[model samples]
Target: MKGTETKAPGVPQALVDLVGDHFLEAARYLREIQDAYPKEFVSVAKKLKVGRRKAYELVRIDRRFHDLGIAPERLRQIGWTKLAHLASHVDADNVEKWLALAETVTAHELKMLLRGTVIDPETRAVVLYLDKVQYGIFETALLTAGAIKDSGCLLNREAALTRLLDGVVVE
Candidate 1:
């Protein structure tokens, strides 16, 4: 499914410049992955021992599937062979399986998978890791990190959630 309409607002331009296009792709991919394996996503994130924030970071940079340049619809037709090609760039561990599952899902199924799954027991940490490892720190993470840097304080899940929910207005 496409991402939720919940755009992150108030992001700084510098952060956007730092992250670039990859960030957007990563965010999109994360939504897709989550759609494919709602329970598995949470389980894997827990297994990886990453918190919600760190999980987000990891998934963001983990763009093996998106980088393949295959159309979402085409993914289902080609299946694992296609996904395997995409998985080459990112870590091969769990992605192979995730991509395979993604191939079986429809856009509407993906959307349903993400609904009510955005925030949960392990979501915050998983999202953070996804952002860091998979997508890399993009505008959202950079702005968040910068805010913390300026304040001389670290922001936790509650803080990040608040800002994210508030919406990061793209300039």
Candidate 2:
């Protein structure tokens, strides 16, 4: 993960230089706390001033990076969010490829790529915070439109939503 001279495409050298080593230091410290104080680990999020999820993420990043022997500077350049997304997928052999990909894409896009989703830069996401009743209605519509499965997984939500919208007859 370090000392490899191959530069990631679309990531400027200046941008990489702008990223500091603070995240790597934080990840290392968090990991130390996790290993030394396993019992008191639950309070780590409060201590770090981050949500529980983010605290755990840092620990995971540190552990994975350490185990994989990834360079701290390389991880710093990639940043925590992307590294966290990559932690589970990267191995010694593939770390550089994944890090390069992370550098070229947004974290959300990287997650999608890891999930086997094709990256379409033009495609966008829309989020809605629906109440229980509204969620039920929306779920039903998606189900009927074949966007979701009986197992409650999304199949092709964008296509389904497009079909649903296209069905509306204008006055």
Candidate 3:
């Protein structure tokens, strides 16, 4: 992905220049500086108030492939968890195939596909990248469904999802 392209049309050139892999490059440069003078990073972190992990994430995200096969815009849409998660499982030759599958499923769903030792494809699963309030609503919905069922069995994630998709089917 050395000369990889990003889907950043319509974005300001200045902002685009500042972010993306270039951002990673900058982070790498900073890490190098810190390596040269270890105490300097402490000052930089204190001034910016960024933790060691935040700085390391930049390096990690940078040291990774120049591109994980998905365009930058698609990456923005899917988020890093999915990209990094899938990238770890597939070799360079199969990265694109897995990434294509990633677009068809939520990041969480993709995780399930990659990591779930036994996935029941007959029973579909839905995964959402929801914010705190949104997750609260989802949790409430699951609880409500369980309360309504009242079958002396707990409403686990699958059962709740099945109830939600009772009349909905995807080909």
User: Clash totals for all models, in order?
Assistant: 50, 0, 0
Candidates by TM-score, descending order:
2, 3, 1
TM of each candidate vs. truth:
0.21, 0.65, 0.41
After superposition, the stretches of candidate 3 with alpha carbons farther than 4 Å from their true spots are: 1-58, 67-70, 120-171
Worst 10 residues of 2 by lDDT: 7-16
**How accurate locally, in lDDT, is each candidate?**
0.45, 0.73, 0.57
Instruction: Name the candidate, 2 or 3, with the larger TM-score value.
Output: 2
- Model 3 Cα lDDT, one tens digit per residue, 1-171: 554433211323443355444444445444554656454655554344446656555445444544444455655565555655654576668867776888787766787789774555675545679999997787777776663334534346667767767846765
Q: Which candidate leads in lDDT?
A: 2
Pitting candidate 1 against candidate 3, the one with the higher TM-score is 3
Model 3 alpha-carbon miss at residue 65, Å? 2.9
Candidates ranked by lDDT, best first?
2, 3, 1
